[model samples]
Target: MTVRERLMYIAKNRYARRIPLTSRLKAVLRAYLHERGVIDNDNLFISVENKILGARSIQDRLRQYGNLTGVNNEVTVSPNAFRRTFCRLKVEAGTNIFVSQRLTGHQSLEILRRYVEIYGKDLEEAIEKGFEGL
Candidate 1:
């Protein structure tokens, strides 16, 4: 599916009372097994009505897809990476550190401090330019 369509599906399926997309994605993933008639389901997006896909199952399928696509990049993808990306995007959007810290569920300022350290130098340069009027 197209990127926009996929995003819309995610939005719709997010927090849905039934059939969350994670399971649906797994259903698509289990397609090969199903095609071999090893599995009975005709639809890939299984009903979250039954249960959410197990975390380990999701990870294993991701690894399988990663292998199938020849995606041998040294970096590993995990759920935490998505959180980090979201945090960085929030910082880039100029959200305050305290607010970002809360959004990220960080119990200590140190987590926010790391993001500040990562982006702080650039912020300092930007800050330096604002004193001409003073």
Candidate 2:
């Protein structure tokens, strides 16, 4: 569940990031890799033509899958949406912002803050907790 590989973005920027995965996610990825069998390539995901999938292709495939599963109907599902959701979930789970930033490879807290949406309940809870120590 450790990400040690470099990820290349569409802008040709490459970055090596380490991300921790849940046990369930790790198991699912392992099963997927096992089912995929051995390939003579370093890419984790390949197209039906046995070629590396570019960022655009991956985004398109995700969008298509979301549409097929009727997820797009519920919300505009995209890769960015997944990123934002991940950030929000981490914050909601009370994970440290700095840890989330590292996991997400965000360069600054300002950029990471954009991905987090704080709810009214979260603010109310924070206020109560703040007063409890006063």
Candidate 3:
């Protein structure tokens, strides 16, 4: 997307987030947005049957997907995992912390930093870089 269009999306969206786009994922969301054409609802994730999906419903779908995909049997499948992973990925990718805080709906930089401190997978590398040429 062009910068103008991306900015417009961020400006107009309530819970704005830019999920990393894969081919199939982009296709899926585009299809979903197309399906929502001319339909206005507060919840973007409203179901086809017009019911707002509650937390439990989303959790159930996550569990189903995890089972279907055979992901990480030792790790519990939950929404927190997705959120923390997103935060970690953004930090590791060198995205500006403020931008990550906005995208992740974190209220403050300190909270976002805590997410980083908790989920950073390359702490050794980070420390090494900090102490480089010492």
Candidate 4:
């Protein structure tokens, strides 16, 4: 896709909303695309029949990989779980909630808050940091 087209894709507010890729992720994606000979503007991922992969297909693939890697043995591995973990990690890493909301495409802070799983240690750390200059 052209640079303008990619920017428009990122600005679009839809289920297929695109996010900015990290440099590492960009390199990995470039390598994968090169390996797959996918130089066109087609979908990044596709099914065996060359069709776009749906959400269920993606989740099924995650589950399959999780099972193969023994990650599903302790907990369920799904896209929603990844989303929650992403939000939680962003919060724990001190990313602004509004930034996380924008990144996650969350329409409301209330909904985004539900995805952040804070712990007692996090609370203690927050308290300590809050009192650091006092």
Candidate 5:
């Protein structure tokens, strides 16, 4: 599913109030929830205020867990990496840079662009595949 869809689903299942929701947004959320099932009550991806598992505490535990499970030189756990991953996925999916910046809560598109990079293999493969089709 798309990032926008995931965000809407998270907002919906967690927000049980009578808050407003766009019809299009509700449709996307319904599809995501139907596909993924409701996340575990204690899953560490939701917010604490929502009485669900969340990222803040999970991040702290991730650091400790990384140190324990990862090689000494490879042990690093960063919340920003998740943001970077989101940015990369959006860019690869043809999301505009401006939109990615807004979704990522970045102050500038310049900063957002720095998070995304064109992959050499993907570019090369596209050229090779085009030649094959020709």
Candidate 6:
């Protein structure tokens, strides 16, 4: 199954919740849980306070960790990095742009376009692959 179609289990608001996650992302989450020794919690991602992490909290903590690790000084630690990377990856992997936009919760194609950066190498590779039969 595709990553977009797989459901991930999590604890939220006094109930269980399931959200879509890619297989690779699922592995990453499982690895993090193993590393952190989390055995019982259903939430794949959580704060140090044992609370399930939401988008805002995850962003805040990511910023804090980036600052602590000196990543903030070298590169901006913002949601844009993740969002844009997600878009670029999805597009590169051949997912439809409109689908990526919906998955990313972007309201417009204009905003989504800003997130997707198509390098010359990507275009060249696509051309080569398409013309390989000839």
Write down the TM-score of every candidate: 0.43, 0.75, 0.59, 0.74, 0.47, 0.56
Question: How much is 126 displaced in model 6, in angstroms?
Answer: 15
lDDT of 5 by residue, 10-119 (tens): 33225422223557868876686676566556342455354655556777776777778774356346667666877999888898878777666666777777888667
Model 3, which residues run further than 4 Å from truth? 1-27, 33-43, 46-49, 72-74, 118-121, 125-134
How does model 6 score by TM-score?
0.56
Candidate 5, overall lDDT?
Answer: 0.65
Clashes of 6: 1
lDDT (0 to 1) per candidate: 0.60, 0.81, 0.73, 0.79, 0.65, 0.77
List the candidate numbers ranked by lDDT, top first: 2, 4, 6, 3, 5, 1
lDDT of 1: 0.60
Better model by lDDT, 2 or 6?
2
Best by lDDT: 2
Please provide, for model 1 over 81-116, each residue's C-alpha lDDT reduced to its tens digit, 9 standing for 90 to 100. 556877888888999978888666666888766654
Badly placed stretches (over 4 Å) of model 1 are: 1-49, 65-75, 115-134
* Model 3 vs. true fold: TM: 0.59
The most accurate candidate by TM-score is 2
- Estimate, for each residue in 39-127, the C-alpha lDDT of model 3 and write its tens digit: 65766577778778777888899899888888857666888788777898998899998889977778789888877775354777778
Ten-residue stretch with the least lDDT total in model 5 = 10-19
* lDDT for each residue of candidate 2 in 1-134, tens digit (9 for 90 to 100): 23543233333246654455667766887898999988888888898778998889988998999999999999877778998998999988999999999877888999899889677998999889999957
Question: Residue 65 lDDT in model 6?
Answer: 96
- Predicted candidate 4 versus true structure: per-residue lDDT over 34-116, tens digit per residue: 78775444888876677888778888999999999999998889988988999999988899989999888888999898888
